[model samples]
Target: MSSDDPPYLMALPDPVGAGKQKFQLCMSELLQLVRVHLPGRMAGAGPSEREQRIALRKALGYLDSDYLIDLPEPFFGALLRAAVYDPDPSFNRQFVEPLRVAFGARRTQEALLEVLRTGTNQERAGAARAWYWATLEMVEDIQVRWDQAALREFVVNEDIDVRRCLLPQLPLHPSHYPGELHPLVAEAVHIGRTHPDEYLRHRVELQVRTGI
Candidate 1:
């Protein structure tokens, strides 16, 4: 829907009032009571994939229009953090799959990007973690570039996540990351991307794609 469309074109609601209060409350409740322990529960898949999918779909639908949309999916981001830092390879697929199915292709790509740019820490981290898995699925599909200028600009983004996200895909070779102050940039990029919150990711990645 275009901004020019009537209902769709309305101004952003007050985040603390008409807009995101409901979402924030929902997140607080879920994080404190529900999602806080999903990873541990996720140790086994037989619990009910179908049921899980249904709940996730419902959650995403509600959060889509919320200013705090990304808060509810913190567990998914944890999975991505594991993928980025955890050494395990085979079993983590369980954590990653539910995340991809719920948030990957199903949710609007634009929604993910929107959170990456402006959402809160929970929102951004959740989205970034989801995005890492999402991007990994399509990594091979990314257009390769010999354009040094474009890649350099991207690798140096002020937003940690943007830089970090683009990093795994950029110049694809470790040798490409420079050896000097570049390591500092790499470390900063790593911390920002791996942060517990996604807003940090949004900021990091922006540094590469645009400016802080």
Candidate 2:
């Protein structure tokens, strides 16, 4: 927010934790911060590492005195979703570790869909993209034991958004899904032509033409 932004934007009523005097923040505020700064702030980070630390400290001080947030399940879920996608690229294995900390940890499909349906637009998009990348990781781990159909059945989720996301990705490693290959390509073509998203349409069109 700008310097003139309202106080209520980061206001809080309750505090949490002992002796530490942590302040609580609304979930909406957290999402707002993520939406506001995020990687966008990385563009012009600082003049020096020390300057960056001071800037971060100043920003942190602006947080509500109730700095200890107790997130509801859905917000926690959103946090987990964000953690997986926004972290260091080398920590792909560590990314999945969020699943263990989430309430819907064991129910992968439900958890995935829940995040998609309820999280912020950017967040849902991230989780949807993460699913495709995560599926690729699983394929690498189990391709020797799992067949094409079995893998597809388990990985290709019920959500159209997710299915469409994964379809174009499949052909990238085409030698694996020998049996179900053609139909998926056809589906991708149909989606490209029919789906509302122009980007997905263009992507599918490219994949079909290039046979990727």
Candidate 3:
């Protein structure tokens, strides 16, 4: 976790510890616990790495059908964001896979798109990262063409995070890039070139070179 993790987390034992303690929290308490504890347990300095993993696993376990229905949209969003912002790439993927299963890809994607369109900046940023990871799984299971429809929707979105997420993940293969996306690619290039953020511009430039 970053040093920036909030102070409240300090009171909670490491998430792994909480899981092992088996406090028998009901779904509501578990959800509330995560809302309070996850940022510190998942994001900040660890009491121990093992404890952190245990905590994450415990939290993911709560996404079972009984608990899933009780989860508020914002709580679900926080779960996705936690997985997306996790520092360890391999572990991040491992942790989020259960979330994907629990949430289901199609519904998760729908929610993410909505967040990208209308949620606050933090939600949109989290949605962008979450969507990128989801696309990684999607690219392999389905034909490349499936991505095109989502790409079309994202390309027109005014949110820079949405475009940033889609542009980098656009398959660098011929099959994925039908000519229809050219205008969108060009538009992205324009936006990227002029964008205030240097990192975003740099990412978009790669698409520019590929001629999208």
Best candidate, lDDT: 3
lDDT assessment of candidate 1: 0.40
Q: How many backbone clashes does every candidate have?
A: 17, 5, 4
Q: Write the per-residue lDDT of candidate 3 for residues 148-168, one digit (tens) a residue.
A: 544554556655544554455
How much lDDT does candidate 2 score?
A: 0.39
Greater TM-score among 1 and 2 belongs to 2
Q: Write the per-residue lDDT of candidate 1 for residues 79-105, one digit (tens) a residue.
A: 343322222223223444544555563
- Runs in model 1 lying further than 4 Å from the true structure: 1-96, 103-108, 120-129, 135-156, 159-162, 171-212
lDDT of 2 by residue, 59-156 (tens): 32223323213223453444444433442222222333333332233444345445555554333434444454344324343333223332343244
Which lDDT value does model 1 have at 24? 36
State the lDDT at 115 in candidate 2. 57
- In terms of TM-score, which candidate is strongest? 3
Clashing pairs in 2: 23-65, 23-66, 23-67, 23-68, 24-66
